[model samples]
Target: MSSTELQDRNVAWFTERPDDSQLSADARHLLESYSRIPADDVVEHVIKVRNQAWTIFPYPCIGQFRFLDMSMKYTKEYPELLERLAKGQRLLDMACCFGQEIRQLVADGAPPENIFGCDLREEYVELGYQLFRDHDRLKSRFLTADIFDESSPLVKLQGTFDVVYTGSFFHLFDYANQVKVSTAVAKLLRPEKGSMILGRQIGAVNAATHDHKTNPTGKMYRHNPGSFQEMWKKIGEDLGVSFSVDATLHELARDHFRFHTDDTRRIHFVIRRE
Candidate 1:
């Protein structure tokens, strides 16, 4: 579809999205408890901010409200993860579109000052403050810079985070660019034993590059668990650092996607700096 047509379709999708009451139990609790928003107003607020975000970038994740789905809660490592964050280690949320994960971290008792979020668009970062209603209360910094741009302001954040969280990212790029992005992420992480890169993404059963309408080059790499591990192995070699990749791939259920398809799976991963 044409760019304008794609935008129109995305707008409709966001406008007609489901109510927040339909969100998963954990997600609903997080919104109600942390955001201090009444259950009656949750859906309206989510829809309003999400519609604004959709206009900025019409991503399927934004339209489908995937940000509300907490991948961290699903992981077995959540307790340890929260402990690390609560201990005052730095955490960065890469490509943090609306800072939903950052807010969730705060709600889980992680120090707000230790959390940071970065995104390419300033609008998304600004909207995050409004969405969580924590402009004054939350101290975490939200920066705006392109992750792929080596000379961008993100360079100042190099080697600063104890953990970096990336969700629904990486698959957006072709293999070569994926390596570049991974390298950048590695640079942002602490080069210590326990530091890690964690999150989830869409993956293919048979890992390979796939055509995406949003990509001008028309290709993006999708990984199965093995391919993802291999990619990180190569990244580790290239960076002169060792990493242990722990990942799992599971069938895509109806709740994970707006449309059901057998070709995709959810890949949850943790890459530790060793």
Candidate 2:
């Protein structure tokens, strides 16, 4: 294909064309039972929104409907997490795409106003509304801004949240940016005991930087449990706080993507402010 063709299609990142197989049962339940989408039309509506989001960024997660993969319920802390949210503690779904998890939480009794979603693209933020078909009723707030931008609107939200659910985030950058991302997350967290961060991301048995599929020199960091904890330990000391990091890796890349990476695993983690 010509460079123009590839550029226009973003074939490098948009290789996978997903169908119903990529959609999860929980997602279907949320759409049908919660969002009130007709059962017959749920798949079509999801495909349409996924394609619309594809135009913004051809992320593997979006194409595979990984955004719909709810990581909250699987966590060991889920019961308490939902309980606290229902009791008025707020949460930020950092890098939330289509706010699927947010909808699930709301469906499971967490207050919609207690949930906040932030994404770098306003289009994705708006797409969440379209995907859930709840613009008129869902009370969750979605912010469209980059966390790295010093003057971004997210700055106004620093230190206000009790929990952050950030699935498939943080491994997207190199070490420096990973620290920056963690720092940004930490800044958003309430600096008190019980402030917590939970979610999953790609990890490697050996911490390293992997080549980006789309860019010649772009790299993303993958961490082992030890390295991840060490980074957070330093961050805690630097910021005069303490933390406990629980991370583990077992699931392989092939389980989620067509392309497989050796030693890559899904790291499930919970970091708590202590």
**Residue 11's C-alpha lDDT in candidate 1?**
43
For candidate 1, list the clashing residue pairs, or say none.
none
Model 2, which residues run further than 4 Å from truth? 1-21, 214-217, 253-257
lDDT by residue (1-274, candidate 1, tens digit) is 6666667753423436665433667776777888788988878888888878877777777777777777766678778768887877888889898898888878888888888899888999888888788888888988888887778877988887888989978877888888888888899987678789998888878888876655535667878889999999999998899999998887765654444246778888999988
lDDT for model 1: 0.80
RMSD of each: 2.3, 2.6
Worst 10 residues of 2 by lDDT: 1-10
Shift in Å, residue 39, candidate 1: 1.3
- Deviation from truth (RMSD, Å), model 2: 2.6
| Cα-based lDDT at residue 206, candidate 1 | 82
- Candidate 2, 1-274: lDDT as tens digits: 3334424543433434444545678888989998899988987788889888876776667756777777788788999988999899999999998888899889998998999999888899889889988899999998888878999988998999999988887977888888888988998998789899998888888998887653222677889999999999988988899999999986753545444467788888899999
Candidate 1: segments with Cα more than 4 A from true spot: 1-3, 10-15, 19-22, 215-217, 255-261
